[model samples]
Target chain A: MTVPPGRRERKKAATRQKIAGTALRLFLERGYDAVGIREVAAEADVAVTTLFSHFASKEALVFEQDEDFEQRLTQAVTGRAPHEPLIPALRREIQALVRHCTADSAAPIWRMIDESPALRKYEESMRLRHAETLATAIAADPELSQTATASRTIARFVIDAYSLAREAADPEAAVDEIFRMIEAAWEVTCPSRRA
Target chain B: MTVPPGRRERKKAATRQKIAGTALRLFLERGYDAVGIREVAAEADVAVTTLFSHFASKEALVFEQDEDFEQRLTQAVTGRAPHEPLIPALRREIQALVRHCTADSAAPIWRMIDESPALRKYEESMRLRHAETLATAIAADPELSQTATASRTIARFVIDAYSLAREAADPEAAVDEIFRMIEAAWEVTCPSRRA
Candidate 1:
């Protein structure tokens, strides 16, 4: 899916981010309902039609940040260190977040999404999609499909724990707190789950 | 919130279940959107107004059975065996459901819910509320909130795992599989997680 490193793709990506950034700022400053699509389009310097081309609806535009962590998760679980069980690999992923925190990252998006029920519901739907991606990825493996439910269940738990931590912490501390909680859950599930 | 177990409350409960049973049978046999609320009211032998009294939406009438589990979960988590950790206690509660499985119980309900996106979204929202309820209960324990994020994160993970196990099982074997995955996750987190 990687577009070749060229101006067209880069410009498209930047325009997409611009619309998102503008939309988020407007939603935060006023409210999700207070802002209109035309305003966002104008602010982002894209035509309204172009903005809608990038996103199906205002809800989709607001929820654009809900990315495929499941893809990263699939990467984490499938690309584990030799002999490592899925749980430990996931535990390490959660822990790494705590060791390094990024404030100008996805936190504001989550914060804004959390503030609105429509957005929260959209994100929850997105969460189901993410879980499916995880389950589907695991189910694809010959050794994983039959046994994958358990691993996927554990993955869901890790992801859920990671979510709660990310939501509750101050941005600077979100990563570490998130990782610490996941590691604790990891310990409870895999008593020997190590860093 | 406990209504006194008098004739009126019992009668109301019976009426509610009857409406739900009627709606579910209709939703499964007919497409959820294909059937109208008037048809459901007619079949349930209740006025449309009466059916609406019991459920906020037709969706609620079809999903009435699910609301009880979260109430039970909140009760169970708050009142676990004195010696057990929260996750194992939660696992045992799910384990208890195996005995409740029947040829005419939750299996059909689960199947119907799985097939609909609206229902799936509704169920996830319900699960988040359940997680929040359990989190609030756990947070009340002074020792937990003092730690800031770990306790709430653990509550959400445990709830997520419970939700996963519930959704992933074979219909006939769902109860057993859910608890089994739960116990497995518990063991992975806590090697000694036991009955």
Candidate 2:
């Protein structure tokens, strides 16, 4: 049902991945602030312009998945099955996200982000934008739109829970705990309906 | 039942206020990062060493009320009356804090904070500390502590709502709106409980 990328698309994707991977390695090795963009381009065997074409900023390299993550969260709510409540829809979306971000291969990257203030601030901005994006989607529905405060509150709570979960020692346990908390939040805001 | 400061204590408080006021003015005029601490000290008619003694860093000067704000949130939870619920107690605390921060006299200071990334980051750090402090207080109680996720979720929800409220054109309305959201949260999390 899906069409794969053609040669040009595949080549661009490969270049982007290579640049990002090389930048991450260099950043992790020499520290984010210390590593220059020229160094990354040189190490990646690409021009500085090519690196800029791939990523807008150094922080963008570390957070390469940000846009995809935001899209998936918005789509999860907007694309929920009929009769499915918002909380469970979000839980499904968040579970997948947490799994992806917490995979075995990503541990070092997560640790790197934890140690860097620049990355943390960048991550925080992304987190706020995620909440805003979700909020807009939630507000599009007439039923949820009427309760603006509650809608934004719920959106923020879910995102914050997900971010907090990332810090847990056991990602699965953290995800489960957050899911339960979401259910509890749903119970208060929408008492007549169940998640 | 409260005691006022002695003459020496009062003079120290006055001096600290003068330095903070001068620093804020200079930061606002020349930008946060551009303004030097020595300039602030000179403007306030105090030695640079004296200014350093009062505030550990420039960021600290910009966020002078942060410690007081955190203490008040913790005390609100800890000092709730026997029958008072957590939500209203937090509401009362947040309302007072919001009023203090959003006063007409504090508009320029808030605007300065809004314009400066360093100030925003410092404020975000303070906000996280507030959540941690509130979570610890929430955990001290037997009922809510059982569910760690819910306790933290609620704490974060309260803090986030308050921060969002500050951006409102009419802060009073925003405060009221946030309080209602808090009540909805309490209803969901603590169903039969009154707090």
Candidate 3:
């Protein structure tokens, strides 16, 4: 995927980042609904059409982050240490967020999602899609899928745990705690997880 | 605080059931958006205002069965065996849905919900509300709440598991599998329950 690096590509990338940052700032300052798309465009120093070009819609400002969340989780799943299971890799990703986001202003992005109905709707549906993807992955696994029915339940339960953890006041500790709980539940269901 | 054995209560119950049953039949036969208030009333042999008295909106008709769902789950929590943990009881109540709904009709209902963004919105919000109720109940339990943040994790995981079971294709194994998952998840999170 060579980009044939050029000024246009660099500028286009910059515009997306700029618009996203501006939209996030505006949304955090004045709740999601109170802020208008026009204001966001103006604040980002872009025309309305430019803003729309960057983010199709205002909701996309929030939803874009959500869409990326599952991708990152999937990356962790695929790139796990050979000895580690999927949950351990997932725990690292969430706990990493607790450190990185809290130190930055990105924490409000999560709060915005928790507070906004539209955003929550987008987030929940996106997680369902992620769970579905994980189900496909689990289904491909010869051992797990044989016993677990396509891994839909396991994937959904894990996503639900993560969603609840995201709502926690402390995402890092919450991640560790949730992953541990899920492990226990898995053990009870499979009994051999304790081993 | 028992109801006096009288016509009013009986009539009210009959009216409520009539409206719900009629709405389900119509929605099942003609699709949710195809029918209207006037049509529902005519089909139920009731006036428009009478229909309104029973169900505030069409969405309520779709979710009317959940009143009993929430109530029964809450009662299961409150009257749970003192020694039995909340997660197992929650598991049983969730598994019980299999005996009733059987995932046979789940695809249509899910399709109806998925097709109409409004129903999906309604169902998500309703689930959030149920999580809140379960959280409050879990919070009140000195034993469970004190151990760790049992309330939120328990509620969310149980719900995630139930949703998984409901969406599963096999009625025979879904509930048993999901319940096993939830209980196992709870044990992992709760120190006392962990192996």
Candidate 4:
């Protein structure tokens, strides 16, 4: 059901990956701020203009994967059955994403983000933006549309819960624990429906 | 039951206030990073050492009120009646704090925080720290002790709910709405207790 990229698209994707990898390496070796865009482009054997075309900014380069994650979240929420509630859909989708993050390939990128203050800030801001977007989706539901502020808070809570789960030593155990805690939280906040 | 400050203690408090006010004014006019400790002392008519005695660093000066807020949260949580449930106690305590923050005098300080990236980051980091401390308090309760991660997530949820309420046009109304949202969230997460 998915279309494969043509030759030009494949080459463009390869160039972007190369540039980002090189930039991350330079950032790790020296420091994020110390590494110049020009240097990263040179090291990656790409033109500065080409690098800029691929990524709007250095921060964008580092956080390129975040877009995909956000998209998945949007799809998970919007594509759910009309009767499905927002919170459960979010929990299931984010848990899958969190599980993927625990894979071997994600370690380096996670470390890169952990070590850089700029990246950390970027990540935090992106998270807030994502929550806002998700809240809009939640509010689109007729039942939830009336509680706009509450919807925003719910979106934020789900994101924060996932973040906490990810920080745990055993993420899978943590996910189960977080869901239980969320249920407890729900009991006090709303008693009408069992989430 | 509280002891009043002696003459010397009152004078020390006054001096600290003068320095902090002057520092805030300067930071607001110029920028957080642009304003130096020496400049703040000069403006406040205090020596550099005197300012240092009151505040260890520039960031500390900006976040003095935040420390007080955190202390109050700790005291409220720890000082609750032995029979009180953790979630209800926190909800009551933080709602009081949210009311205090809604005062007209507090608007400028909130704006200062909103305007500065450094201050925003400092605020976020403090929120996380407060959540961690509150989580400890929540975990100390026997019923919740077994789920440390859940306690943390609950703590974060409370703090974030408070933040969302504060941003609304009517903070008190928002607080009420947020509590309802929390109940809804609790319903989904844990339906047994109607906290």
Q: Estimate each model's TM-score.
A: 0.69, 0.80, 0.76, 0.77
- CAPRI docking class of candidate 2: acceptable
Q: Please, what are the lDDT tens digits per residue for candidate 4 over residues B53-131?
A: 9986677788878777887777777787875665567678778998887888877777877887667766676677788
Chain A (alone) TM-scores for all candidate structures: 0.71, 0.83, 0.75, 0.79
User: For residues A139-192, could you state the per-residue lDDT of candidate 3 as single tens digits?
Assistant: 564333335552676676667666666666776677777778766665554534
> What lDDT tens digits, residue by residue, belong to model 4 across residues A48-77?
999999997788888868788888888877
**Regions of candidate 1 where Cα sits further than 4 Å from its true position:** A1-26, A35-58, A78-108, A135-146, A170-195, B1-22, B36-54, B79-88, B98-104, B139-150, B169-195
Candidate order by decreasing TM-score: 2, 4, 3, 1
lDDT of 3 at B127: 74
Q: Any runs in candidate 2 off by more than 4 Å, and if so which?
A: A1-16, A30-38, A45-57, A173-195, B1-19, B30-58, B142-144, B184-195
Q: How well is candidate 2 docked (DockQ)?
A: 0.30
Give all candidates' CA lDDT scores. 0.66, 0.79, 0.71, 0.76
Candidate 4 vs. true structure, TM-score:
0.77
**Residue-wise lDDT of candidate 2 within B106-189, one digit each (tens)?**
888888888887778667767877897888889788645435655776788889878877776666676677667566655655
Winning model by TM-score: 2
Please report, as a residue range, the 10-residue window in candidate 2 chain A with the lowest summed lDDT.
Answer: A186-195
**DockQ scores for all predicted structures:** 0.31, 0.30, 0.46, 0.35
What is the iRMSD of the candidate numbered 4?
3.7
- TM-score of structure candidate 1: 0.69
For residue A90, model 1's alpha carbon misses the true position, in angstroms, by 3.7
- Clashing pairs in model 1, backbone N/Cα/C closer than 3 A: A98-A175, A98-A176, A187-B189, A188-B189, A188-B190, A189-B188, A189-B189, A189-B190, A190-B188, A190-B189
